[model samples]
Target: MEYLPLFIDLKNRPVLVVGGGIVAARKIKILQRVGAMITIIAPTLCTELKKVLFKQNISWIEKKFQPIMLDKVILVIVTTNNAKLNALIYQNAEKRHILINTVDDKNKCSCIFPAIIDRDPILIGISSCGTAPILVRILREKFESLLPKSLGFLSKLAGIWRSRVRQHIVDVVLRRRFWEKIFYNGHIATLIEQGRPEEANKVFKYTLNNDVGNNNKKGNVTLVGAGPGDIGLLTIRGLQVMQQADVILYDYLVNSEILDLARKDANKICVGKRVGDHSMSQKELNQFIVRLAQKGNKVVRLKGGDSFVFGRGGEELEIISKAGISFQVVPGITAGIGVTAYAGIPLTHRKYAHSVVFMTGHNANGDNQVNWAALSDYQRTLIIYMGKINALNIRNNLIIHGRSINTPVAVISRGTYQNQKILIGTLIDLEKLTRIADYPSLLVIGDVVSLHSQMHWFGQKALNYCPTYLIAHSM
Candidate 1:
């Protein structure tokens, strides 16, 4: 609350800059975009500013700072290195009520530069009151990734349609709801993204006329991958879907904290599945999704890792498709890849493993569908999901099929999380090593497991783990 945040229109207004250095050049470019009439008062201009003085309609007074220069300007920017001269300009500008911003001097600044994310009309400003500039920069970078580049096009299109929409929909609430659907549908945005503006307009008009405003609209289902255990692993699209979800059906592997990303009023249901334990049967879950979508509620089927990778995402998608429900799949970082990296066990290495295969150990009685003979190839790093219970069988069968028992292995549980547990050993002690891990664990088997000793990296555990004992520990 030290400084009030405001966006001032500098269009056609004269703004004075006291320095011609790189910092001044940077600010001048921003002002140029906003159609500001810039005038610089510097004894000598930098090479960049000299180029700008010639190319742009800029006025430069090759003279020292003086009080008379502040008369015509509405705002003053002091990037001058001379402290006494900067203070003189600030005092004079303040007397005339002219907004002044002194570079790197908060006390003399009437305004400060904020980290701005400009998606045209979608402008977001982040500031730390000039206290933590680096933190502000980092936050801005993160926001830059989180926000879509096509947002400007989307906003412009929305602006163009505003009058037409207002004229058609008289009611304020209904109009707001219509805009929400228009934005959330992403059809127009996708068309714009794919460079089909004419088709986008046609669809936009069609959507406006035929579909929206009422609760009778077909609900959407976005299958989001909650990668491994770390919430950061979730994709930007997945986070957006979660925020828009009217109902979220999540699994046991999904971090509970991820559920908080959903809309405040969103209905969250735990349909998590565990081995030999049923929260809601898969059939029941599929039916439930269809039932919810039939009632026009945006449903988000949140699963851990990549939903397509042994997460039974394909099964759910098939059911949704057959039901004629619109669905989107936001692919996640599956545990096989995400967990191995977090545990510093490479799925493929140049010297150890040339290929990697991911599989599931969970199966019903009499299900011998596994191709263990092919999986026994040590050259292909094998990543097994839910293989904790069947560790003994996997270890013995692989060895029985001529695989070396001395092959290195690592069992990672709740990978990418703070309390994640990882035990390392060889195939000889696979079962014993797995016994230390809980559910939602992965088995990484190959010579690449030996690389864990070299590249032991992650958050706390990896950073603090003793590399000396990486000689393969068992239970």
Candidate 2:
């Protein structure tokens, strides 16, 4: 982020090089690839620039570094062996507010050349702000091998059919989904590499024609879990469905980075619900998703955590089935498992707890639904979701039902995220833990909670100023 990456059009643009040595020749060769009108300002020419002088559209000025050479030029390059002369030209370009690159000098450089992986129209630039040029070159070579040479053919084909796609698929979202489905799945690329562009065009036309919500088209709905606030926890199938979705209905708990993986032009609507802040009622949302799928639009219901575990996915799918809509469920890493693992708390350790229970703190009827008798077992680890608000109730009920007040407990908030925080205490301090914890937090109550001292790994990266507190709390 230190330098903003840019790809400028240098075709036929006027540019000046203030030296005629090998380094200057290197810059000139790169400029030549972009077809820049080059003017070399130096008293003598090296073997490289002398050979370059034979090329057309290249002008040589047999003179020392002069201030007038930078006038009316789009860019400037200072590659002279004389350090003072290069600095002088750099200062002149800076005064004129023109982009300039002083070779091997980061401070004097207004721009720096990047290691490029060129696949014709598909150009990938790798740079490290001149700090690690060798590392960037290695990365460029890796990308050059990973990306196929036929990539440019696919991009160019998309360009040629862009107007035709727009004409056929009236909806912008549908058109983008059409392209994402083809390119991301590598079907069009394979056809082009096989030298069957006519077949590729036919595939494009067929995809576009079928995207108009016709009655013959039966749309699909995918219930995908986005995982607990981390893009890495998302299932491969979940990411695929998101990329192919024409429309996505995501929850508030879903990570913004996970949502960014969807097709660029896909319609993303927030159906997210907070504790008391409901954007859309679940009843209305269930019906709305079904309606979208019935209309031949591929819809994705993106929920946070596992779709089946307290995510109300079954209720939504039941409604989808009643409406006779085709649906698929892509499971995701539930917070009960993923968040606990990140916090270094194992749900069931044979020496500490032989059994584990997954429960919700808040339900439709408030607090009466929980079976405290079954939950008070000594050898069981309890994982409670949406339990921050009822932490006091849970503490009192478990103690009243024969669970020990001295049992270890932990409250983890925003788990698996960079801002994740963990608070460790005993069941007696559960109310205090709730006061310090945020909403959408998880509660781990059992002897297994004490094992966090030995197993703790992830700490809040933003808490670098309080290292002592972090270590003391984890211990």
Candidate 3:
């Protein structure tokens, strides 16, 4: 610990700044936000500083620095270009016992500006002891993405309830436990973020009576969709539940990168199921989740894409409900919609196909349950999920049932991911197009596939895909 980290309240306090350039203006802005009464002593003020002169807390003097200006000043900031002058001011402030900060000079700084994430009433400060400023900046960027923007609002709401909570609970240990329970309940945060303050107040009041220091410990479960291999696409509500979860059960397709965002102490269990690989039966997994929740653990069943879309989420919900467990679902962007957008293939186009159908090609009985005749219409787009192994059957059925052999087709594997691959061909070449691609591929049939070349936008090599009939379409 090279420097002791402390957050001092500077509201309505006198502070002096010894320069008026852009850097100095930045320092002034931070001070202003903290309600500091600031005076800048310099020959001229920068354009930014000039714009804020009318502010009640800011004052400027168009004069050079002098020792007498340190009188009654609680702190001083030196941002001048001249090293000698900045050092002179630091020495003068030091002799008078006034704390000083010199911009870009760690030795002269009695205080250094830390990287701040201001969720007002809740501020997170990060510092590298002024040794690794860039590293600290990178850390700030990472946190900026992980933290919800509604955090400040949540903090403000908590502050509003503090007095009431303290009055009702009375005991210090009980009050602390009560607040911890509130933080663990994702529903309360969801209500506050959704602009439902009245509903949120009701929940808070309910928790105060039923949950505060109560021995009746019954935890809940949340079904969260991880989306299509993109951590940025995870919902705010999903992130909140993940952070609060004591145990997380994830699938094979759920992005590992997204799981890294969860609490470090969380227990992660791999209940992933593939086509022929069964980690655990669906019934067994459901019982496991219920058992964990019954023991008062916050359990999150994290799946890939929309859990309702062939993710067997409905089945799990049924099982959990039968077990008398509380559960909620946080929907995610399903592959039928998300992957098509990334591959630049619209599921429905007015000039091409108006109606879009999403169907599963991998039926458990290995039978063609979908109506090939109805889907053969040229006016509709067909999006088949997990259709790679059954590509030959799908092609034969579509062509045998009035579809054109020359109809455009596309197979997108690992859509919206860094290693995603797209293959283009006609219906006659459907099997060939899917042969070289990876599993979890999406099969798109109809004239909409022609738009892939025109709308290709997701990855760097999107336009560089191998195609059997590139000459039939315009690139």
For model 3, the superposed segments whose C-alpha errors exceed 4 Å read: 42-47, 145-175, 182-197, 210-213, 230-240, 264-295, 308-383, 389-408, 416-421, 445-467, 470-475
C-alpha lDDT score of every prediction, in listed order: 0.82, 0.81, 0.84
Q: Candidate 1 vs candidate 3: which has greater lDDT?
A: 3
TM-score-wise, the better of 1 and 2 is 1
RMSD in Å for all candidates: 4.2, 11.7, 4.7
lDDT of 1 by residue, 1-475 (tens): 7888899898999999999899999999999988899999998888898888965658999998889999989989999879999889989999999999999999999988889999999889999998999999999988886676767888898999989988888989888877776554544654564467788788789878877565465676878899998988888878876876789999888998888877899999999977678898889988999999888788999998888988889999999999987677889999888888888787887888899988877641124677777888879998888888888888888887778877877788778998888777778788887776666678888889878767878853432222333444432
Higher-ranked by lDDT: 2 or 3: 3
For candidate 2, lDDT tens digit of each residue in 387-408? 8777778888899889987787
TM-score of each: 0.84, 0.55, 0.77
Most TM-score-accurate candidate: 1
Writing each residue's lDDT as its tens digit, candidate 3 over 1-475 gives: 7778888889999999999999999999899999999999988888999999889899999988889999999999999989999989999999999989998999998888899988787788999988999999999977776676677877888888888898889999887766666543545765665567787788788878777777545667889998977777888778877987889999999999989989999999999988789899987998899999888777899999988998999999998898877677889988888888888998888899989988887851235577778989988999888888788888988888899887888888898997788887888888888888787788899898888777988884443344556655645
Q: Pick the candidate with the highest lDDT.
A: 3
**Relative to the unseen true structure, what is the C-alpha lDDT of residue 224 in candidate 1, on a scale of 0 to 100?**
88
Return the lDDT, model 1, position 455. 81
lDDT for 98 in candidate 3 is 95
Native-vs-model 1 lDDT? 0.82
